[model samples]
Target: MLTTGNDTVLSKRATKTANTDEFLLTQFEKAEANLFHAKDNPEGIVNMGTAVNRVMEVELIERLTKPDALRFEQRYMHYFNNSGLLELRQAVADTLTRHLAPDNPVSPDNLAIMNGAGSCLDALAYTLCDPGDVVLTPTPVYTRIFTDIEERGQVDVMPIVCKAVPDNAEESFRLYKETVEDKILETQSAGRRVRALILVNPNNPLGDIYPPGLLLDIMKICAKYAIHFISNELYSLSIFDEDANFQSVLSFKDIPDPERTHFIWSMSKDFALAGFRTGVIHTCSSSVMKCLGKIALYQCTPSLIQHASATLLSDKAWCDDFYLKINRQRLRDRYSCCLARFRGAGITVRKAKAGLFIWFDLGPYLRSRTKEDEMDLFQEILKRGVYIVPGTQLYCEEPGWFRASFAVSEVELEEGLKRIQQVVEERKQKGQVSWSTY
Candidate 1:
């Protein structure tokens, strides 16, 4: 067996290094090899698997224009700062405070900037968790969360499995405080130290937001155990629902454990700047801030990108009035259109109020209630020229559920949906609809 407990056969040379590295390299290469390449398959395949804002190019271009954008200073080439540019940190602090933490303002001193949220999570996991320590999260989550923390941190992720019951109307996968506590206790009893609890508010893949009350309850549990609480609010501003009532952990006036709480945000999702790779880490823990200051040296964003991002965030009028408002409206419109397309095809999707994707069940389209059947369905969709992520990839407890990002152009979204409809209709006609096994 490999060190990471994988069943892969290893050579003598492979035994010299960590097996987890090889495992992750293989998984990443596989994704690159099998997944649709947008440029190459522009007309051939519809990529709905990646969670990104491929839409709204006009707004993005407008924001990064010459007159408004920042120019890099000659001094930026030197190594005066590696944690982050102070100006950029302040800008991020001010922007996040204005939107997500008005009551409890975030201080620039408490912020650590990095290349991306994935790097921040990796650094955080390394800082907080010892080898073999467990971190708990609810699934199905953004699949990268697993690789981000586990590959380098070597921490075990124990899923707080939320089942999808027959009564799906009540949102069976919703996380509860009691369930979180139970999972923590269960992990502890099995001789593992639960180091932290990570919550992705305005959750990815699911696109659901947790209420403030539930967030507080979960925070209290983490407090009781004296463990860290890492809240990835990358999608906080992406909420399209007028009534979703999204709350940031920074907004909470009274935190259960101030020192153990940390929050992460990024320009990737809300600002459609994934390529820019700007991520922020806000912590109440001074120790964490200090540790991050050290770790950030290895994961710092480019000085020029940091300057440009700072200029963008510092534009209060543009950020609040034009960019954010228009982005949210666009997301709402696209998500609504996508949902309508699914419903029009007699498919049921979990009603989403935030984020960029839809979670829908394809159990009826599966040949059997197994991972093999799920992959078969996934492959069939790919064969139909549409690419979507199967639930199995996201560590979903149940099979036949898939996440399809609607953050593509209307042309792409419609093409993908049409492919799905054609595939389903043909399968049904061929008597392949097998919900009987479900």
Candidate 2:
């Protein structure tokens, strides 16, 4: 008989996932059970942990419910393309060409549409690597990547742990070419094959974009090692900083390993359409595309939903002229408000240029600089009716760091911050050790 860490009996195959530490989902369940609403349940929990942008909900509803947006057709009710509708893929290609790659226009034939970014990653894992092969990604990242790659694919994620320097908090967790190569060599020396490297641009939690030169250098390294390079541009259209120089890998003309490089994007973050369950993958390799096609039936999006998505994406007037421009402004405003609130609460936050969340330090509130203490503070804040993710769950080697989304409504954001402030003040009054002393 096999059992997980919580002592639930299961088959050997099932125990593999059951034994893994997926605490984020557990916390999310708790948060969802008591979600806060302005008039309905003001005393309920405020979820700051999930990376969802709720600011554009009304706008999305308005556009999606229009006459031509989601019109039903008889053909849509029958089986069509299992990979994706040609209409939707072409629309995605056109949209990516306009925003991401001006020089190299994207081709619809190279794309594979899935339910979401998680499905894309899972499919890539299955196609690119065999069981027991390693995929490298820098930490602290979105924690779900671990299970996404490993759960059913039976692959392992090797973390290229990037530490935060005390003197340069702005450049904290920055991934360097040297560090990447070193980790690759180290993993090879251990007799493990490194099949791929994943780069999250306009990174989640950190929210910093990689410079083009660095990207080129890393791509060259992947070429040298004959490994796959995956560029996850999930937050491509969410850049709020006027000075942010975000260049998608799709924009690069001379990719060192074009055949081995892949790009991923989704409507979830940028368009505030997480419920849409639409994700796109663009790869130049025909072999990879062939492999993906065989599995597309298992992860394909509904034809009706694909039609609606195409309608929204193909409308250049609405998407480019109004929605995107207004969305960026709203994200900028919300980010500014959240940053000010955290700083005013006497907490230290890492300045971010993009993404829905902010990575801030709760070191001052910890009794000691340890993950246990970090989680203690997390539970205390949750008890006060606010839920935020602790950094340890994201494979952050250091303690006392946390990520919280500011994409909620203004009222919810204020209430969540107030609860956090109450927890901090309570800790301080009880004479907890500050960051300086710790």
Q: Which candidate gets the maximum TM-score versus the true structure? A: 2
Candidate 2 lDDT at 134 equals 97
Which residue pairs clash within candidate 1?
none
- What is candidate 2's TM-score against the reference? 0.96
Q: Which regions of candidate 2 deviate over 4 angstroms?
A: 1-11, 18-21, 436-438
For residue 140, model 1's alpha carbon misses the true position, in angstroms, by: 0.8
Residue 91's lDDT within candidate 1 is 97
The runs of at least 3 residues in candidate 1 whose Cα sits more than 4 Å from the true structure, single-residue gaps closed, are 1-43, 67-70, 167-170
Give lDDT tens digits, candidate 1, residues 1-438.
635465456654354345444322443354456544446655476777777797777777867877647576787778857679998999999999999989888899999999999999999998999989999999989877887888778898888887776537247578889999999999899888999999999887788899899999999999999989999999998899998888899999999899999999999999989999899999978898889999888999998889899988998998899889988898899899988888788776888888889998887788886889988988888877777888878888788888898888877887888888898899889999777433
Alpha carbon lDDT at 178, candidate 1 = 92
What local lDDT does model 2 show for residue 392? 87
Which stretch of 10 consecutive residues in model 2 shows the poorest summed lDDT? 429-438
Candidate 2 Cα lDDT to native: 0.90
* Cα TM-score per model: 0.92, 0.96
